[model samples]
Target chain A: MKHTLSVLVENKPGVLTRVASLFARRGFNIDSLAVGTTEDPTISRMTIVVSADETALEQITKQLYKLINVLKVQDLDPEEMIDRELVLYKVSAAPERRHEIIEIANVFRAKIVDVGRASLTIEATGTGDKLAAMEDLLRAYGIKELARTGKIALARGSRDA
Target chain B: MKMTGAQAMVRLLQKEGVEVVFGYPGGVVLPLFDALYEAEGIRVILTRHEQGATHAADAYARVTGKPGVVIVTSGPGAANTVTGIANAYMDSVPIVVITGQVATHVLGTDAFQETDITGITIPITKHNYLVDDPADIPSIMAEAFHIASTGRPGPVLIDLPVDVSRGEIDFTYPERVNLPGYKPTVKGHAKQVHQAAALIAKARKPLLYVGGGVLSSNGAKELKELAELMQLPVVTTLMGKGAFPEDHHLFVGMPGMHGGKFTNYAITETDLLLGVGVRFDDRVTGKLATFASKAKVVHVDVDPAEIGKNRPVDVPIVGDARAVISAITAELRKMNAEPRTDAWMHVIDDWRARYPFHYHTSETAIMPQYVVERVRELTKGRPTVFTTEVGQNQMWACQYLRITEPRTWVSSGGLGTMGFGLPAAIGAQLGRPDHLVIDIAGDGSIQMNSQELATAAINKLPVKVVILNNGYLGMVRQWQELFYEHRYSSSTLPQDCPDFVKLAEAYGCFGIRATTPAELDDALVAAFAYDGPAIVDVRVEREENVFPMVAPGGSIDEMLGGIPGGPVSEMLDEELFEEVWE
Candidate 1:
């Protein structure tokens, strides 16, 4: 099962490597990892999407806690948390296909970030499923290139993640 | 006071209550060494190699329950200590390693003697630091010691650039470290403690499975109290040796691949396994599904990850071993729990007598077991510390050498590194100057770190090296014999193996060689009597194998050898024998 973990760590040198290396060494694959400074400048929050079972997830959390810079780890529940991923797609849109690509982008609430003679770059932010659906439709217009910012999540309501 | 980083490091060591440091000097460490030379109340023992220094520091930590300190130059010097660092990492020994790197300006340029030591040691160390400034020295040093010696104690490394070491800074050592992520749980959960106590009080066939954590927490006294209060049978893992007195009535023996047959059988039959400070390692748990299959496991460990790691734990108590064991004892006392394991003890005693550790006697060649037994006899009732090199010699010592107190038995238990014994004994002797330190070594393993004999001799440590000269890597040879159609391969030593006696003499130490049983006692006595380091090489049977063996992946109850009357396969009925092979 895929688990999105919110890990808070000391904003210090090599903290990222300490965490990434731990996951690598323990054979836990990180599906997606996004790091950013939290409200507190001295602490950073990392939203890590990893695929592991209950036992392995427990192990991952425990191992993460063992790192000196790691402050907290929370296995976010899929139902009780909100997740978003940003993706930009540069599609090979000729003059004739530009209208169709723009129409599809409108339904997904995606923005046309860049336009060139032969391409239209569309940017979208949503849950993983929503982005995948938008990407699927854009592929019909022949995607020239694509970039994705891995998923970031926060707990529902006022509870801290 | 303002001082150079190297001088501040020396002051930090002194402030940390470090009396001795095991290290090897190299190009980049010159500044640090110079500062150390002038440091008062701290003695630096230079080792022949960085690896030897690390192992010696590791053993010193094991014996003294204090973090061992090591300093070495970068690149090759740091690389050489990898094995020793990994060994300590595996066994959870506390040691702080300092590696001198190139100047900060040339750190990543591959300058002379530069290495990414912190990167290399990340997975092996509990934590590591690569200092960017000299001002961080005091706090980093304090944190390094704190992290190394706390919780699940393990090795920590600090990669210090020479320029940083030479940089001047104000030294104000912190009285306490502020590591929010590293606060180890010291007390077990109240509900979990109650649950564990209830289970223990009701268990009819309870067994206490102890490991290195007990000794690491200084919980041997607490462990003994729990076992005696509950009248539980005790089985110590290789790393847990001396956590409970081997002479105690409740003591079964060491349990694992090379452990006693009865201890393994008891593990198989127990109803409740209250594992204290032990991770159910693969060596201890053969075929995880069947290991302690009949038992309800209650595991207590300082590291929460260890609980239910290898096996499913019934009641997990995450706390220090000393705290948890005492809590369980206290809880049991509150309930007026009575000893319910009399029947269990009877069965254990029966199996112990029926399947004793045995070897065939030969007048022509002395048995390795006999040598260990003699050493044990000679060192009886004395403050003795026994360290062993890896392979057959280690297994033999584990089987025969009875350790009555904690910290007396030190070996490379987890990594099973060869060449650990000699330097470890040297470190052990220095740590406990009044104790008799002995290294039970193999011919193959002794030569790996034999250069350390010079260090031992120079220090005049009364350490003894008892080499079981079998002329082969006996463990591998035994494996090839049993599992690979008797092809010797490359396991045998060269025909012109070094004369260990002559090597000892050249190192300015006493040397003795004994080829027969009659000569074993005399050699051991003389080596023990020597005021300086001594090596006693005893030629043992070349083809001998350590028995009571659990074939890799085999169930613990079904052993290959060590049956009292005869081989277990032949003795059992045809149907049962088929199961044994299976």
Candidate 2:
């Protein structure tokens, strides 16, 4: 199972290296991670996803907590949280297919961020599964390139996690 | 009001209650060493090698329950300390290692003597720091000590670049560390304590599985109280040997591989296992699936990660061993819980009498067990600290030497480093100068850091090294003998291996040799009476094997080469015992 942990850490130098190196040392790598400042300027929140068994993840989380700069570790359930990933896909398109791609993008409430002679870049933000479905549907049009800002999530409530 | 980073670090260390520093000087750390020359408070011991300094510091921490420190330069100097760092990390010893780095500008350009030490040590250390500025020194130092000594104690490294050392700052030692992520739980939850007590109260054959954590937390008093209160049998892991008094009625010998037969049997039959400050190490829990198969385990450790690491627990409590065990004791007392233990006690007593640690005497060669037995006999009842190098000698020391005090028996428990004993003995002596300090070493492991004998001589430590000379890597040889048909490849050492007495003389310490049991006793008496460091080498039987052995992957009960009735192959229990008894 992949566990999504929202880790809040002090905004100190080398803390990211410290956190990343911990997972690396344990021979486990994060699946998807996104780091940004939280409401407090001095604290940074990292949303990290790692696929591991309960034992390995618990051990890794314990290791992460050993870091001097790390503040709190809250494991979030995907079903209870509102998760989103912003992805930009460059799709190869002919003049006729370009309009079709734009029509599909409109249905998904996405935007054609860039249009080139042979390709159109579409940007969309949605849940991880939704983005995967969008990528699958657009694959028939010959996707040229893709980039994802991993995943960022917040609880489905005003309560602090 | 103003000082360089090096001076600031020295002052900060003093402020943190650090009294001694261990290091070997090199080119990069000259500035730090120079700063130490000006600082009047701290005492530094210059070891022959960086690794020895680390081990000495580790042993210092092990005995004092304070973080030991090491100062070594960059590159190979830092590399040499890796084994020691890993040893400390594995055993959960608190140590802070300071290494000098190349100038910041020259860090990645393959500068002279520059190594990515922090990168190399990432996996081995609990946490590490790369100092960026002079001002960060106070906070970094504070955090390093805090993180090292707190929670489950582990080694922390600090890499100081040359430029950072020379950088100036106004020294203000941080009053308190600001580490939010590292708050270790010191008190067990109230409900959990009650649940554990209820389980203890109901258990008919409950056992207290103690480990080094009890000793580290100074929980021996509470542990003794709990065992007596509940009338539970106790078996300590190798690291936990001194954590419980071996002389107590409830005390069974060490459990698992190379442990006494009765201890393993007792563990095999327990209904409820109360583990305190212990990880179920393979050596202590032969085959995990079969280990305490019938028991409901209640594990309490200061480190949350260690709670269910090896074996899952029925009740996992994360808190200091001293605090948690004390709390549990308090709960049991409040409830006035009494566990029925007559049947369990009878079985344990029967097994102890049937299979005590045994070896037949020839009067021709000194048995290793006898060497340890004599040490115990001679040093009996006095405040003695026994340290050892790993391998067969370590197991013999563990089996034969009886301990009543925590922090009295220190060894390379996890890493099993060969050279640990000598330097650690020095550190133990340094830590507890008024007590008698002895290192029971093997002929092979002693040579690994025989250089540390110089450290003892120079400091007038008056430590004793009792080398149980079997002329082979006895443990490996024993395995080869039983498992690999005795094809001793690189296991045997030439009998002429640097005559220990001459080597000790070379290092300016008194050296003695014994070939028989009587001679061994005489030599021990002389060594103890000597005013300075001494090494007593005893030529023990060459082919002796540690018995009550659990072949790899075998359950603890499937032991070999000990007193009969075990469900395994036997070599010499009946014959050897008859040979001596007749």
Candidate 3:
């Protein structure tokens, strides 16, 4: 089981290394981690999707809290969170499939952001499963270009992220 | 006071609280050496070999929990430190290796003795730098120290072009490092802590598979409390030998290859493996797929790369070991403690009685096991520290001695490097002069850097060296004997033994020889009774082999006693006696 956690930490040199090192020493595998500053200027929020079961996630969160610089760690799950992923996908669509591609995009609520005759760019936002399903449906159509905003998340309740 | 870059370097070291540095002098490093002369608080030790200097620095780091600093010249001088840097990298020792390069003008031109040292050392170091500007020296040096000492500590190289070292610049060290990509995660997740607490609350057969990280994090107390609260038996990796008191009932001793049979059994049978500060290295987890086959592993470490490097983890706590363990213990405290059933304990006792750690009795000569046992007896439950070099001697120490405290046994765990014992012993002796410090070394291993005897003598360090002389690379020879039809190639020691007594005397240290058990005991008594450094060379039978031995990649069940299959004479029909004695 993989858990994605958003952590707010002090922007300091060696802090990322310290975080990575903690995972390495503890023998935890971080699947894909995206670190960037949030709305708070002084604090940097890191989105780390770690591949570990529930017990390990708990321990990882507790350890993160112990760091002097880390301010908070939040686990964004489907039940209590609304997750959005922005994907810029370029698909190689033949001139003959242009009408078919537009019809498919309309069904998934995807917008045609770019058009280059042979290539078409689609912008989509949804849950990870939905995005993955869309990709699977479009595989036969061919995807020549693809980019994603690795799952930016927010809690559903009024609690600040 | 404002100073030149060279002076600033020395001033920065002084301010950083570095008391000692080990290095050799050469063309490019002369400026730094000259500045070191005027630098009052910091002292420097000139090593015969650059390799020795780096090893000394590495040993210093291991002992003090601080970054060891080594300074050297350009090109070959910088290249000579490759092995030492690799050694430190392998073992994760905190060391800062500073080397002089050709002047900036001649850097790319391949001047007299210039090399792209930063590039060369990048893969082997935690980080590296090439100082383009002189003013950045103080901050760079401070950052180097910080990087080398924090997180998953390892060697960091700083290749200074001669011009940069000699350039004039103001001196002011940075109070904090601002590395954007170098942030380290230190705390556990609150939800993760709660889940871990829940796991512990429900676990019937819980075991703490502790490793070197426990000692690195100084989290021994937290680990012990968690284990005790959950009533989980603790087994340690080689580097984590003393994280918990070996005398405790919950302690199952060191696990994996060469580990106590009971420890392996405990690991095999556990339902939950709460591994704290361990990487599940190959040596500890013999077969990755079969390791803890029935257990759900909870790995907690500070290094990201080590996670999932071996066994798959059920709970992967990617954070500092100390922080995670402390939180788990705190969370565990709130849960109602459930009493453990004696059924599993009974099975462990049965395994203990069946396959205890016992050696064959040989009346023909002095056994290395006995020697190790004697050392433990001599030290008792005090602050004694034991550092060992590679090969048979290290194995003997691991098997025979009982470490009741953390940070008492420091050796080259990851690298398994020879010549590590002597310098590490010197560093440990210096770090804790009041404690009895000993380095058990093989004849072949000690010779790799025996010149360190002078280091001991010059410093007047009371480090007792117990050299087990078998006249060959014993471990390799044993492998050859077992698997390669006894085709002994370069394993034999050439010619005759050097007069070690004379060698010690030349270095201004006392030396003693022992061939028999009584003689060995007497030599140890004298070495311990003395107030200064001493070397006791114990001559043992050349054919002695460490047993019960497991062939490479072989399971413990296939162990060969002194003789194959049939138990050795002393161990025969002495099950209860074996447990008591071992």
Candidate 4:
């Protein structure tokens, strides 16, 4: 199962190393991870999504908790999480179907980030399924460019993963 | 607090415990090499070729179990390292390859010596980065090391532009690497462990198939315990040769092509195949459809992509091999025993009797098998590491050589990479200086990176190199003779050797030549007795071919045997071998 672990760490020297070394020493499969600062300047948030067994999850969480700089870690379980994915898709919007493409974007609540005479950039934020559906619908219109932030998530309610 | 971009890069590498780098200087990489020169802690060893640099780094990693570091220039230099990167990827060696890319401004402009190296290496590397900002250097380097050394370890590239390496920055190495989608699991699931145990307990003819992942995860002890508890006969892949003690009764030796015939029969007839850390490669499994057809295969791997990539698994456990093996061993403590003593052992013994690792003793010339067996005898299975280059030499080493412990045999299994031995031996020697490390090289393969003798001499690494001089690409020549109607093209080159003894002397190493068995034995003894690197060129017949080989695109059971000039046919049956044995 793919797990998204959010770790809030001190933005300082060798912090990335402390976390990465822990994973390497333990032997875990880290699929795709993104680390950057949140709204706070001093604190850095890392979202690590890797697939492993339940025991591995426990071990990873336990290891993360032991780190001196890591403030928090959450295993964003799929059912209890609201996973949002952002995609910026550039499509070939011929003059005739430009309006039609805009209508499709509106239906998905996606906004047109850029407009060109023969191309359109659609910025969409939703579940992965939603973005995948949007991409499929827009495939007939011809896709020129595609960029996606491979799924990030947060817990649905008072529960934090 | 402010430092030059080059200094920052050096500082970053230093913090990551990078002691040495293998690379060559070029226009694009000059600034980086200059910075390395100025740096105190990091030492750079200049290689004759960029590919050699990468392979040396890879060999270092394979031996040390740490990420090997390689630095090179862009364009041709970067492209040259691609083969090494692919070799690492296929064999899952962790290497940090830092290349000097064209400056950011000149990128995409196709400037002189500029190539889209990052783009070219996308599929080959675990992760790659093009540092646009000097500040990102530390973070990127840290992340690259992390990614390279972490689960399913492979090559990671950092394409640092010349300008980026020269630009000024206030250096503060990253303390944290935050990748959202990249968290690996270090622990095995309790429930899955129990499930695995239950499967093993119930299995009648269970076979344990170990792979390189076991060595990578440091799970040999756990694997041994698990094997002991279950009493399962173990068969390893080419890369998995050293995972278990080959001298043990339960150790059935390697499986698939060139593997022990008993191992092949066990896999073919087994009721359950507990495949741990192996990626069902074509060499291991001749025809996927017929492989382990009678057995229920339970695959355990850290990488999820590999689980269903080859043969579909009856039970797929995605976790670290060591952790999973420990967990399974722990779970097995609760299960009742059905020791496979009488029936299973009898069958395996029968198979062993039927098809033994044999050769017709001849006094015509020195045989490659005799050399390998002699090496094995000299080592006494005390965890002597053997690294082999591709072709007949590699096959001979795998077939005749014996390893008694985990992580003792390193080779380019999946890639079948030639010219892999010398550098790999150097890496293995550096990894464990106390252990005996040997590079079994073919004449054709040795020339690929013969310059690494300098690297060994400079480092004073005692890597023993044994070159099987056949004067031809023996494996390919055999293929041409068999399937291609004897149309030998570019396979045989009669007069291209550069007096290897002189070459070794020039590189500040000892060298010897052996034509007779006693000469070969003396050479080996001398090579092992040396305090530093030594090379032994064993001159074998030019037309020699590796036998008991499964013809290309054929089943493992369909083996070809007999001498190169002799009438070849299917090997004799089990009864004939038993009668001879008796």
Find the candidate with the highest TM-score and give its number: 1
Candidate 3 lDDT, B293-351, residue by residue in tens: 77887778787556665677777777788899888887877776564624455556666
Model 4 segments beyond 4 Å from truth? Answer: A1-161, B38-41, B336-338, B381-383, B562-582
DockQ of each: 0.90, 0.64, 0.05, 0.05
Which model scores highest in DockQ?
Answer: 1
- Estimate, for each residue in A94-132, the C-alpha lDDT of model 3 and write its tens digit: 899988888878888999998997988999988788889
Q: Which of the two, 2 or 3, has more lDDT?
A: 2
Interface RMSD of each: 0.6, 1.7, 9.4, 12.8
lDDT for residue B454 in candidate 4, whole number 0-100? 91
State every prediction's TM-score relative to the real structure.
0.97, 0.94, 0.76, 0.77
| lDDT tens per residue, model 4, B234-313 | 99888887789877888887877777666676787677889898989889888887778888888898876577566878
After superposition, which runs of candidate 1 have C-alpha atoms over 4 Å from their true positions? Answer: A158-161, B564-582
What is candidate 4's CA lDDT for residue A14? 53
Model 3: CA > 4 A from native:
A1-161, B339-341, B494-496, B555-582
User: How large a fraction of the reference contact set does each model reproduce?
Assistant: 0.96, 0.83, 0.00, 0.00
Q: Output the worst ten-in-a-row residue range by lDDT, candidate 3 chain A.
A: A62-71
Q: Is candidate 1 or candidate 4 better by DockQ?
A: 1
Candidate 2 local lDDT, residue B397:
90
Tens-place lDDT per residue, model 1, B1-582, is: 999999999999999999899898888888899999878998899999999999999999999999999999999999999999999999999999999998888878988877788989999999999988999999999999999999999999999999899999987878788898889999999999999999999886788999999999999999998889888999999999999999999999988898988888788878899898899999998889889888999999999999988988999999999999999899999999988777678767867787889998878789999999999999988889999999999999999999999999999988989999998998898899999999999999998999999999998888999999999998999999999999989999952379888899999999999999989999999999999999998998888899979899988777787874332223334343234324
**Tens-digit per-residue lDDT, B313-405, candidate 2:** 999998999999889989988998875787668767877898888888777788888888889999987899989999999999989999888
lDDT of the candidates, in the order given: 0.91, 0.88, 0.78, 0.80
